[model samples]
Target: MTAPSSPDTQAENAEVIARQRVMRVLAQAPDQQLEELYEKFADKPDWTFARKPETGLVMTRGRIGGGGAPFNLGEMTVTRAAIQLKSGEVGHAYCQGRNQRKAAIAAFFDAAWLSEAHKQSVEANIIAPLEQEQLTAKKDKLKKAAATKVDFFTMVRGDG
Candidate 1:
């Protein structure tokens, strides 16, 4: 048997997850939108890249019909960045395609979002709107997809 995780560990894990979710939303938003959101911050916090944004290829995988055997889909381009705020908070972002600046902005936003100074503004103007946009897009896509979905069922007749 293994020991239970400490409260600190749980909190750390939660923070990591939140950061990842923020990074994902940031990655999906347009650069213009993110930059506009960044303007909401009262005072711009200075940040430096822990690692400069760079592009690379990642192999994507897909499962047959969302189940069964998994197979390699294809290699896709991805950009990643890591930034550290002056106050010592570190942020990392990974985004699809080759947009180094976008990745950097996202990483910087991630770091700034975690800062107590910018947390409320980030949540209100950036994360909330982006999340709502994502949710709307997802719902629309699902509705479209559902329209074409085929459902087949068999009915047992009492007479038969």
Candidate 2:
């Protein structure tokens, strides 16, 4: 018998591996914790912040009114953030909301993910939670929308 196929096994594997790599980098905090990582290279001249346009499309599968055929949604625009540590280490992130603080925090986590020692803590405390939260919110919204689905169908006689 043949084993079942996973359509996105490679992509999922890549994402998981990337997450692991980030985790490992964040585990090498020199200051005893990931939170203090910023001060480690705070004095570096490369440290700076910038704003830019980000774009993405969430390909979602859903039944119209919870019982119809699945369909795709269009793309969306987002704001991206970037921070360069004094040591030339760059942190980047994209968020749906235009919040500076969230961007800063994401950049901080990205920087921590770049650290070899503090990577695990950063993944556990920051990246993982945020990712989970976003997934949960998306699922909830989809479910709610599905609950209110309305179906309309019409039939016509051909050549009476």
Candidate 3:
């Protein structure tokens, strides 16, 4: 009942998806890890703060039983920043907690990812490793939780 997307539209959607993935990884990454990766970059491009890092509280929402009515789960601290590369690419980041430095670094990487010249290196050195580490951590946590899982069964009585 809808028209198919054109090639240009598809390409734009793909670009938006890729940027979303990058931002998701950056937002979930630890501040220490982001700082370390930022330090290791060989060519850090010059960038100006389009918006200075600022901390604020955001209301979080949750659904009851995963599918029921949604409710506010209280507020959590969040920091956000925006940066513009010298070449005109603009990047923005939002992260949990009050780590302004982390937000700035993440915004820098977001802008870097937008630039063709820096995308590959940023993906390889920063995004890939962080993704791998997070994956490993998740697996380990699941494994540990799985170890404690219990199964129960009842024996039937013949007298019935």
Best by TM-score: 3
Error of 3 at 93 (Å): 0.5
Deviation from native of the Cα of residue 85 in model 2, angstroms: 4.6
lDDT of 3 by residue, 9-66 (tens): 8888888888889999999999998999899898899999999999999999999998
lDDT of 2: 0.55
RMSD of each: 3.4, 11.3, 2.5
Best-to-worst order by lDDT is 3, 1, 2
lDDT of 2 by residue, 1-160 (tens): 1345376776777766785554334332222333444344332244467544344444546688988987765544434567766555667765444444545545656765666555577667655654565568779999999999988665666852
Candidate 1 lDDT score relative to the true structure: 0.86
TM-score of each: 0.79, 0.44, 0.89
53-158 in candidate 1: lDDT tens per residue? 9999999999999997999999999999999999988878898989898888888888888889887877777888899999999999999999999897768788
RMSD of 2: 11.3
Error of 1 at 130 (Å): 0.6
Winner by lDDT:
3
Candidates in order have lDDT scores of: 0.86, 0.55, 0.94
- What is the C-alpha local distance difference test score of candidate 3? 0.94
Candidate 2: where are CA atoms >4 Å away?
1-81, 84-88, 94-98, 151-160
Off by over 4 Å in 1: 1-8, 63-71, 149-160
Cα displacement (Å) at residue 46, model 3 = 0.6
**Which window of ten consecutive residues has the lowest lDDT sum in model 2?**
26-35
